[model samples]
Target: MKKLLIAVAALAAFAAAPHSASAGPCGLPNQTTLWIDFADGSVPHWEMFAKPGVIGAAANFIYPPRLRAAGAKTVYFDLNFRNRIGTPSDPEDAATVVDRAHRLFDYAAASMDCPTPWIALNELFGAGTATPWSATNAQYRANVLAFVRTLAARGGRPFLLVNSKPYTGGEAGDWWREVGKVADIVREVYFPAPSIHKQGAVLGSRSMRQGLRRAAADFLAIGIPPSRLGIMLGFQTTPRTGGREGLQPANAWFRVAKLTALASKQVSGELGLATVWSWGWGAWSDGERDPDKAAAACVWLWARDTSLCDGPKAAGPGFNTSLTEAQITLPRSVQCMVGAQRIGQYDLARLTAMTRDRDVAYSALFARAAESERVRISSERILAAERNVILLRFGGSTSAYRGALARAGASEQVGRGVLADELRRAEIKRTFQVPQPSGTEIAAYYATYSAALARSVEATPAAPWLGGAKRGVALASIAPPQVFKLPTGRRTAVRWFDGIYRVRPLGAPKVLGSIPLAQASGPISIALKQFARTNAFQSWTITQQKAALRRARCARDELPHVAEVELASYLPFLAID
Candidate 1:
């Protein structure tokens, strides 16, 4: 009986061996698990939903000390220093900043003393900063190196945050190699811009699949093992020049799925851990709020067990064979689709269905890019609207000129017209209220009027026209027709506009107002409006006019118009006048 049982068992094992090996382990797929680095000190209420056993947190650099004390699992230290260094007042400030940052790190490490890993050493200053690496400034670099050496020496393994821009490659690579000599893991923080245009044509143009491939290659070149490296998805609100804004939060999950799918295609089996750019700080008005909720949703979607090895893993039929051959096999059971239905639930079947849905990937990419485009267009429209207002105020076109005054409201226009009439009356009265000038004077005045009228018609909305017209009228009223001398020692040939003097420079054949001066560049070139103010002549001068031009440029570049106008009052007399 025992011999018969053994024979039966052996037969059973032989028959099941092939099928059992083919079934694989727990249907586990070659998917990347999502982790979040909640850089903001505060945690959001929504984080409670993250997969209870798998979720990890990266506390803010300054606030992590408290978080560690509170028994948080992971803490991230910002390795770089903040505060301005080498400013005019503090040439030695860079050294001080570095020292302070190091001391802070040491204090945190000493206090925590836990065996749990220190996940990220978030080095600050990316492409936007003047300093690419701490080493760009020798003293600062030395301090950072010391801190890095300490981390390497300790049992803690740290990953460095890197920017998308390639500008810091040399410094980053050098640091990585030098540090790797001692550190157990030298991982990188990758923030690839989602949209092709935002990332610029070169990086973004690559298909999600292609981008991941390149990222893998780039990482390998930098000496990071495929297993050790991780990718971070960022949630940025601002759009590029041609991008949109306010993307649906759901789209964030879709993007992650797409990136993960691509990453899976590049590497065989389970790729290393993945992290979202943030967790928490979602409730705070600034930074990404609801990050916890978003992160929870992403992890719930990605944690499903499915294989990527069962399906025919080609990049499709006629594509680059080299690229195709590199494609990683995917399991038909793995779901990559994302939608409203499966957002919060961590159920297995629903997740698999979402991941496999091809439409979800396409829709997600489209929506994210559209949101980015909307932001870009809206910003441009606002800027154009402001330029339109400025042009109307300065250009001498009757339409724009009238429109500007009208927009200023009825009271402002009425006051300006009344003041101009009073000035005209005063001038006529000073000449004994004469009904008419002598025939010779009349001909000269008429000629001046013709020239002035021409200039008024030809004037572009700009500062020079306003200032020139005011000065010409003043000179014409006080001096003889053709040979009036300006207060600035320049001679003017006069013309008249409704009996007011208009002047032109003598040497320049072109009418003075019509002659485009090099100095009169940009939208609102002269201080015409200032000349209309009380004590007009005294208030408007070359120096004052030039200052106004500068202010206009500065205002357009900096503050919005409403704020600019109010701030204008505080500017130097030259700018305001």
Candidate 2:
């Protein structure tokens, strides 16, 4: 933590702060606000909170049965007064959102005896690189201030949150201080540390909280008070029913809850007001059909008991052994005070080093010697991906960069970051080689096309998984099932055959677990053989396995040999009976 440029005097107080565990959940108080990401979902299912907590709705136009229920508490409505990524210059449209948010707040307050009623705004922070409403960071900050002032003029509680880097779009004003005036609290949500995961050193499910802690230090250094900031516990990796997705450790929910509590402590000085982003997204994009329930239950764990979320004091000796070099950026705690914030020219170099160092750590778990050099080049690639993401957000852009991202496997966060970094450097180098006009053209090409290229690299299933048998080989070749290695962590995989999946300990024959076709989603293939005649069935799957069993009735000739299976995710294996 070498740098002290951001705020020297104020941060000096943090020098002696001990890293002891908190006695309980950071005591964030009534600040826990629930959320309904979109208005189009089912009747806001507040039951999942299972206990008393805030329920936030992004576009809850009308009051509902739950709000009227006895003992119902706080319900926040996130404002969508205007198109967040649409035209940036229109102050009127932005004003409309402020006005509407106020109205929504008033209606809820008036309709029920709710204890706390507030309005929040998020996601207007556009996707990709642009700021809210597709405006520059400065413009976005001003717009937010404008909205805040509007709400303050009439006066109830109004808050603002964005899912971007700390202080990204809001620094145009006094940033921390000015916005703090009108906002109930100014907030930026930090979700999964895909960056940490990309580093591969954060380790186990518990370490994901490391990103939140780092981001918290950054936020504090920049002047956002602990009382005002919040972190939304989000999933960087989507959950699926089969393959690597299903292999997610069962303790995932516990890790998230504990991290949420740990992260809450990071920002809350004595004020004890760290907010955990909750409420839920409308539905899972992958289309898993878990009827009567929202397909993705990712955010469900945020409202749990905070006491259990704390990481225990080292029970004994080995607790601190595996700390990765990338975990702590600078040597001393004071240096990190300033080290956390990336200001001015220091932003690029500092961030690049940090990003590259982390990826190098991840390389140990995921990369081989032959690819080590290319892996080291991750810093440049990520910078390019960043630039490309920004350009892709430019007006008139469609999914033009999708093809390139596919080529680079950069659609994922880690890939997108590397490609964005690479494109940025290329633009700088090109500016010196050609005329300004030509360089500008080249820069555009790099930003747009290069980003897609990065996405393609990550999306490349084969890079993550060495080549394995694609389809069935003769059963005779394997009198007994042969041993094959399986990658671990998110990349770890297993193979599905017939109705059984063979999961092993990497290369060992010891079976770790078994996943039958009954629990799988999507499709499977099969074949049934009776006597001299054999019939191949492409559509046979778990859904039909039971009925087939009933008809066969287990008679000798009637019993048919089961054959074939479907495989997904990047599991390493050979085809088998």
Candidate 3:
């Protein structure tokens, strides 16, 4: 290894003649940087950095020329060193640091169109070693600063990494400010993966953002400008092997990953900091290995700027639930976010499904809202009692319930609100005031619509031995109502009672004409009951809901462009399937 290092140094010296560095691909001060650590020459997720959204990737240990050859723009050489080079009395120690940096720069320049300006000097201060303020580390501090300054003197932008804040007073703060003048000062801020996937509201993930903001504030308080500051987030493991449980159940992790990008973007835009850097894509220790790193990286890219790549598709509920290529538009409402709970286009789409006319949809929305309010007022105690029963169905595991809810695009609060609406609708049906049709009325109705009532069933051979034969089965032979709702010519995967064949509708269903009163009585009775309840529910609430709508003050804005988004953060708890 020593011989190899010496040979590389000799080669670097031969290539050290200064050449004008070419312009890098990334336009800085706006775009983020994806700094990944690889265990070996082989990059498992090479496709992640094969584009131009980020400021290019800062790689560790991987040969710069190899990465560039793979079509990745290698922008930074990530060097991990945690201690001073030599004793204070060693005159060659400071010179050694400069010489090493030059050799690395030359080696990187050999493969690039231009020399990379960025060099991430990672973890220069060891954990619990002499603090920046400690007198015991004066020489240590001087050597580190010399390394940073030397890199800067050669037109290189070196970012110094510290495990944590290493200062106690303004004196150390002054020192950091001096270092910041020449190089970026970054800190590693990591949270256990399990914490991000916790149950309930997104408080855990929100707390993570809050932690970042607070850390940034601390640096700013110590006189470091945001331009010279950065933070590194750790994505080190999957839940299975790491000592610290990583993000789990896939959906929750993806949600957090996307949110983390948004949160970091918010902080950077608000605070003017250098971009956040990502770490832990390598096959390192158990705590630093993530199997889903590729997907996570894609999500991060998509969240920052959609032009980079289509994000991972998440299967959930509501209109446009497929997120693989969802083009999100802002929720179109003046008061969308003004309520106790934010209203989204998802809710608007549900209302639209109920009715096509805007007025009718608004009426239905108000009716449901009023019913929800009434349920909350009159049946709060009952619902509260059912909460435990509902939890018991998930084996009392809040995490499982939350994970299930996340997959369904609902949080516990939304789930409970839906439950209340369901209960109110059920009660309305139970207490419906419609009188049953008289025997004469039933007979006349059956005679008029019998042909429309007849169910249609087209049969397809279930076994290969049947030679793929298909035939229309007699309507009378099959049971009623099962195939009644099947659309015309729509093939259904459902099997028949004997499982001998699958069925579909060969033609639109027609009423059973001239059927016996006995056979027609059951179908007629069911149809009447369903019609009465539906009519009564709509009419009964329309007038009262119109009055409520006047006071509701909902936005007059039209529905937003239909799109789907990951709902893990929004609906953290949903009923288990």
Rank by lDDT (best first): 3, 1, 2
Per-residue error (Å), model 2, residue 533: 72
The lDDT of each candidate is 0.33, 0.33, 0.51
Model 2 deviation from the true structure expressed as Cα RMSD, one decimal place = 26.4
Query: Candidate 3: where is the Cα deviation over 4 Å?
Result: 1-43, 56-71, 83-92, 111-113, 126-136, 199-201, 238-244, 286-289, 314-577
Candidate 1 to truth, TM? 0.36
Cα lDDT tens digits, model 2, 1-577, are: 0121122212221222112112111121334232222222342343433233333343344433343342224435554545532223443443344455456556645543332344565544531233232334334444555555545444344566654554334333245455555453434443443333333332322243444545555556656556555555443233532111322232433233333433343333223444555433344454322232221232233323322112223112222222222132232222111112211223223332433442332221111111121223445444443443434232224354444444433243433433432333223222222212233443443333321211000111221011122222111112122213333212323322211223222222222112222311000111111100111222222223333322221111112233222210111111122
Over the full model, what C-alpha lDDT does candidate 3 score relative to the true structure? 0.51
Worst 10 residues of 2 by lDDT: 519-528
| lDDT of candidate 3 over 114-202, digit per residue (tens) | 54456676665532243333432554455566666656656666677766755536445555665776777777776665665562223
Output the number of the TM-score-best candidate.
Answer: 3
How well does candidate 1 score on lDDT at residue 37? 47
All candidates: CA RMSD (Å): 25.1, 26.4, 21.9
